[model samples]
Target: MKNTRIKNIIFDLGDVILNIDVPVASQSFAELSGREQSEILAIFNENEIFRQFETGSMDEAGFRNFIREILEFDDLSDEAIDTAWNSLLLDLPPERVELLKNLGTQYRLFLLSNTSSIHITQVNKILEASTGVKKLQDLFETVFLSYEMGVMKPDPLIYQKVLAQAGIKADETLFLDDNYDNIQAAAKLGIEVIHVQKPTTILEYLKDYAV
Candidate 1:
């Protein structure tokens, strides 16, 4: 079942292996800030601060301060803000864990995600609670995070960095992501890519190789 050409596999985190609902987090923030959910969603999608936070240009404290300033709620505690921000992260299904474990045996697995520290903390907690995994690093050879690398997906540099760091050839690696842009970017770099579209998950896409 193994693909001889692909010696390495790079996975995207949100909506691929882990479930995420942006609207859910927006609704939670809406409740806390007394703003419409749409407004919160719009800000998340359009705001530069969110991207900056993910790329490590803004620290957690700075992000929280910006949240207070924008939401006009200086009294909001850090815990409350974090809860609202992390509410989007739903769960990591057991099936996905099994799939990754099985794939790890036949391929060098890696995780490359555009994410922030706060979300990753919640992701680890969720992973441990659901799959008994203490950390995501246990499931992959190397975990490349945007915050740590100061670069994100769809940027050629990030993909190049991953290939260099892992010592994997582009044509010999397969990249799976829910984002079309990310998939195309990887493809343009000569890496095999699968656009893990909605209604079709990574588990289903790689069913042939799973277990």
Candidate 2:
């Protein structure tokens, strides 16, 4: 059930509103690097590559170059590296965009994502191509990216920043994301949260809070 006091909706990008092809990313990486899926994933989880990218410690080209070098690849073209890096991004559903557009009419909407420049570039290319869908930039009152913000979700500070930025009370905002740790982080901050596992579909989970 939603908090009856909710006045704003804050959304997470990836699996919440956008469909991420994790398998595509993993498989592509494995094939390109000649490493087993487990090995590649282990590096992803063990190292803070994604985290560093998000925090702007590294740029997209640098990130890709590091991956290529780590895998001992010999001078793969930047485009090829980018393709492997971007293979995970998929289109945002038109219906979901519509839902956000309609909701934007009533409540404040925000986009807070733990994503990087490379990944967001892929998302933007796909999203901008859609005509009828609400542009992600337009749907939100403000956009906060972890990379640009110097913080990531599941960190209490990020949620605090969102609330502070929106000028909304914690209890007045409903935070949505696919990651449980992030949901838990926001919950600990006294903001209401929803765990969205279904990619490209949020209306089902938002029924209780629909205005």
Best by lDDT: 1
What is the C-alpha lDDT profile of model 2 across 1-211, one tens digit per residue?
7667878999999888888877777778898877898888878777767788888888877887777766678677788777877888876777777688788877889999998887777787777676443346767889899999898888889888888887999888888899899999999988888888753358888876566
Alpha-carbon local distance difference test for all models = 0.91, 0.81
Candidate 1 on 52-139: residue-level lDDT in tens?
9999998999989888887889999999999998998997998899899999998999999999999999999999999998999999
In candidate 1, how many Å is residue 157 off? 0.9
How close is each model in CA RMSD to the real structure? 1.5, 2.0
- The parts of candidate 2 lying over 4 Å away from their true place are 131-135
How far does residue 93 in candidate 2 sit from its true spot (Å)? 1.2
TM-score of each: 0.95, 0.91
Please give the lDDT score at residue 21 for candidate 1: 86
**Superposition-based RMSD of candidate 1 using all C-alpha atoms, in angstroms:** 1.5
